[model samples]
Target: MQFLSAYAAALIVFGILDAVWLSIMGRLLYRPTLGSLMLDNLRWAPALVFYFLFPVGVVHFAVLPAFAAGSLQTALVNGGFLGLLAYATYDLTNYATLRVWTLTLTLVDVVYGAAATAIVAGGAYGALRVLASAGWI
Candidate 1:
């Protein structure tokens, strides 16, 4: 459980940092095309894991603060970011949905942490219990 909590927090923090960075970059260069959006930018939306992780990270870091600060071109990209983040976050959020039966932002990280702990502990306990009953040394 402790390990799960730590790993999950790390993952979320990494995500927040990546988003802030993307939003920042998106606000900066104002790339003319997604083609030149950035390396690995918006490249893989289809992949369930790590999809939009790169592009979204770039766009989030680039655009978010600008939007909060009331910048012009910054807000324009919000729609695009929303589309990407929605899907990407959805993919990432799915990590927890299976266990808790809910898919809200709150459960996104919670489920991941809980599931990890449950899986690890369950496995270990099952193995130990079986070993003990079997009289194995």
Candidate 2:
């Protein structure tokens, strides 16, 4: 039903976008394992948690299925703002010190966060518009 499609859409968008970002990260600075990955990724996690949680994920997957219909908006305003803020902070911090490790991690966070927000929001909005036009709203 609607629940399946909504979850499908969100997962598809997030997965593809995160994959691309992770690819870029791996190419540039290599990948971290275990705890280090978590530490490096923290800068972006707050916004991402919101992006996936209590969002279109909630509205589309839960509310829509319950009503046998619904609308979907990715709510990107906050996501974009947070991504930008975190990127700027990381950039400034990295610039001042520019330690190889720190710079690498911050760069990864900045790029990944921005790209993730743009791709996820853009993908979701496009899908929502398509669904809306198809009367899947």
User: Count of backbone clashes for each model?
Assistant: 19, 0
> What is the C-alpha lDDT profile of model 2 across 52-125, one tens digit per residue?
66336433433343333332222354345445565667676756765344655666677667656545544555
Error of 2 at 108 (Å): 3.7
Q: In candidate 1, residue 68 scores what lDDT?
A: 42
TM-score of each: 0.27, 0.50
Pairing residues by index, what is the TM-score of model 2?
0.50
Kindly report which residue stretches of model 2 are placed more than 4 angstroms away from their true locations once superposed.
1-8, 32-77, 85-100
Candidate 1 lDDT over 1-137, as tens digits, reads 32333233334544565456457644542232223424654545554356224333323443333334544344334433443454446546554554432345334334443333233223333333344457651
